[model samples]
Target: VAGQAAANQVFNSAFWVTSFLPAVTATLIAKEKAQGNEDGVQDAVCQAIFVGVFIALVTTALCFAKPNQILSSVLSQDAPAMEYARPYLLVRTFAFVPSLISLVGFSAFRGVL
Candidate 1:
């Protein structure tokens, strides 16, 4: 029960971060396309990819470095839950980059379409 709860907390946090990727990417792409700047569109997509990957890398490092502090702040005072969440959080952080990139790609496609 504790572990599952912890995992859910970690997943939810990461999901929140990823959820904005599509909106951001879509906005960037649309703005660039509206200006009729082909280069701008490419630049926006590239920037999105780079920024997403950078964010993921930073997030992963932070979670791995300070899992206890992060989990503690977000989760309850349950030690066992925190312990279980730490590893799960660390693992989930790895998905951030790819997930963000895919979202951005989808957004770009929608903009183009």
Candidate 2:
């Protein structure tokens, strides 16, 4: 759902995703056979990627939004780290929508029916 909304905004590709399930199935099936997963590896990859991206976004925000003093005490003494993290977090937050689309679109194709 999130992917669908974001894709609609970023490109008119949501319709294409909906229509592209058969190709997705063919590719995923080949991958699954290669990987030896009878249980559907595509769903597993999608869920894992979603969780990974979510964790990354959360960690980025936590480090960036909190104070330097807290971050320093918790992570490292390098001021440069926090400085670097600030922009990184902002970019990651903004990137959520696009990354979300790619992640979700690939996963969505598996269960598209």
Candidate 3:
């Protein structure tokens, strides 16, 4: 759903967000099991946000705001795909905010350990 110029942003963002969850969970569980630091909430949250906000504001915003007409310009004359892309992209864009909160919260959860 991301355009050419925004590819790296999307890729990097996806990398961080995806990799973060498992890593955080694993680290948190390990730290808890080992009775490690429980005061890293701010740092963890800041890190998660550092990774997410750029992609959310730039790439996701573009996808949501791109015109339905632009689909014709960007994609081949595939009517069915365009029809679905529009709404799906919009939905994903709109959901990005809340989803981000949840994801960041999950990351923060790890910090509590």
Q: What are the runs in model 1 whose C-alpha is more than 4 Å off?
A: 76-78
C-alpha TM-scores of all predictions: 0.80, 0.34, 0.53
lDDT of 2 by residue, 39-110 (tens): 776664465555545654664455456634333443354644555544443443455545545655555455
Number of the top candidate by lDDT? Answer: 1
- Residue-level error in angstroms, candidate 3, position 19: 4.0
- Report lDDT per candidate: 0.77, 0.47, 0.53
**How many residue pairs clash (N, CA or C atoms closer than 3 angstroms) in each of the candidate models, in the order given?**
0, 0, 0
Instruction: Tell me the tens digit of each residue's lDDT in model 3 across 5-109.
Output: 233333344335555554664465445545654445445456566656665676565665663544545545455556555665555456565566667677566
Candidate 3 Cα misplacement greater than 4 A, ranges: 1-17, 21-40, 65-76
Worst 10 residues of 1 by lDDT: 3-12
**How well is each residue in 10-111 modelled by candidate 1, as lDDT tens digits?**
666766776777788888889889999999999988987887778777877887888777777667666767767777777776777777777778988877
Whole-model lDDT, model 2: 0.47
> Which TM-score value belongs to model 2?
0.34
Ordered from best to worst lDDT, the candidate numbers read 1, 3, 2
C-alpha root-mean-square deviation, each candidate: 2.2, 12.2, 6.8
Give me the displacement of residue 68 in model 2, in angstroms.
0.8
Please list all clashing residue pairs in model 3, or write none if there are none.
none
